[model samples]
Target: MSSKRDLIIQAAKQTFLKQGFEATSMDELALVANVARRTIYNQFDSKEELFNAVIIDIWKNVKPYRPEQNDEAQHNPSKGLFNLGMAIANYWSPPIVRSFLKLVIVEGDRFPDLPRNFYRLGKEPMIQSIFDYLTQMKHSHLLKIDDIGLATQQFIGMINEPLIGLGLIILSDEPDMQRKEHVVQAAVQCFINGYQP
Candidate 1:
């Protein structure tokens, strides 16, 4: 059984995904959620608040890096980096994420905080995780990186360029997995080669 809050959130996501944030109304949300209008307000103060909750909920679904899984990767830089690239690719390639991103792009001007909030909620933490992983790799003497931040950006760019810059923007279908793997593997190999002692 779902809580009232959870049910409302799920319904809101579906409604927003289908009709977008700007067009979705509280009444529509109540109807879809099968809850009273007051119940919706009791959980979320406003539509903007509910939309932010939806973004946070989506971000929560994307897996974050686990520090406990670091030991094996620390011993092998190539393996570690390939795994990291794949994780990033996997996170960004989801249909729900793509839909959310499109919504952000479309609604960002109207709600100035939307894009920033989405980045803070989703991309920022993932970037920090990769940065920390790179730092750990450096400390372990697995790789020699002059600037962790730049290296992190470059590695992420490499993974994102094709998947998002090309695939998502142009294609209607999910970005091809083989292409994603190729890009990730190539990026990892290039990164390893550049950082080798």
Candidate 2:
């Protein structure tokens, strides 16, 4: 990501956060980005294109990955599961993640295609990550999953159960540690109940 692109996405996020997706215009983005109107068009062809870019940028940043734990997990499988719970909990609790999610949910109906695109780019990666982790656990003989897909669903359900309500946006009430720890512990416990060998 170029610095300019980052600037544009940040500006878009601010614009979307303030004015929302429907009201935000390219001119507003340009003003916020401190670039010329033509500069915005040069980077993005249209408002819809700019929205897609901003949405992708946000999803990519919050994407879950386990590069740090992968090598260690080659020897210790349990650590991978623990790391995943922590990552998922932390990923969801971030203010930016919550903002993007709220934007998508709120504006999803106006742009019918947006929900599909966001689901593909955002949630699919998390599901695939959990599937891979479960596969590794099966391979390590630490867990026995009759069906990886179903197990993945269980993992996601546990992680997301608490976030199903609208209260996901109300972040100031709880300490960050407590919020994430509760999610992490719930996720790990549920996963183990279904996956323990």
Candidate 3:
């Protein structure tokens, strides 16, 4: 049953990517999922809610790194910060997220509330996660400041600026690991530079 739900989500994602939100129908979603039309409603109350789920799924593999659970085998400040950078990279590099970027750019007006939902699931988690880690860093004297929210946006813009790409990401013929690493490295360094006392 869970697998069926996953399948429906995957199909919905593809459907949304291929056809803008305004064009996709529940019938099309059912066809792509290979499920009965009735089954989709059984699992999802509305297309909007289900679309929000599809967007959330793009970042599902990257869980929020809870320090209480994760600090058992932690390392120094630099290494810990670097790991967070890699996690951000991994979370945003997926094909699903890439398609999601396109949908946001092309269909921004069609689904008025989607941007809020996307930010709610995506940036909200990143903001809280960064705040938690920054609080720990604060106590350790690694960072000498408050105003985590503004700092959060700055660091995100650093690591994510290239990916932002005017709200689009273009995959080159070859995957560029060097380019990928550079964004994370620069973003992490930006935070360190600002916080160093």
Candidate 2 lDDT over residue span 1-197, tens digit each: 56777788889988988898889988889999998999888888887778778778777767676634578865555567667766666666656667767777788899766667767777778778878878877887878789999977877667666654444555443236776667767677767776678
Model 3: lDDT to the true structure:
0.73
**Worst lDDT 10-window in candidate 3:** 166-175
Best-first order by TM-score: 1, 3, 2
Q: Give the winner by TM-score.
A: 1
> Which candidate model has the greater lDDT, 2 or 3?
2
lDDT at 13 for candidate 2? 81
The residue ranges of model 1 lying beyond 4 angstroms of the native Cα positions read none
Give the best candidate by lDDT.
1
TM-score for each of the candidates: 0.88, 0.80, 0.81
lDDT of each: 0.85, 0.74, 0.73
Error of 2 at 51 (Å): 1.7
Task: Give the 10-residue window scoring lowest on summed lDDT in candidate 1.
Answer: 166-175
TM-score of 2: 0.80
Candidate 3 lands at a TM-score of: 0.81
In model 2, the worst 10-residue window by lDDT is 166-175
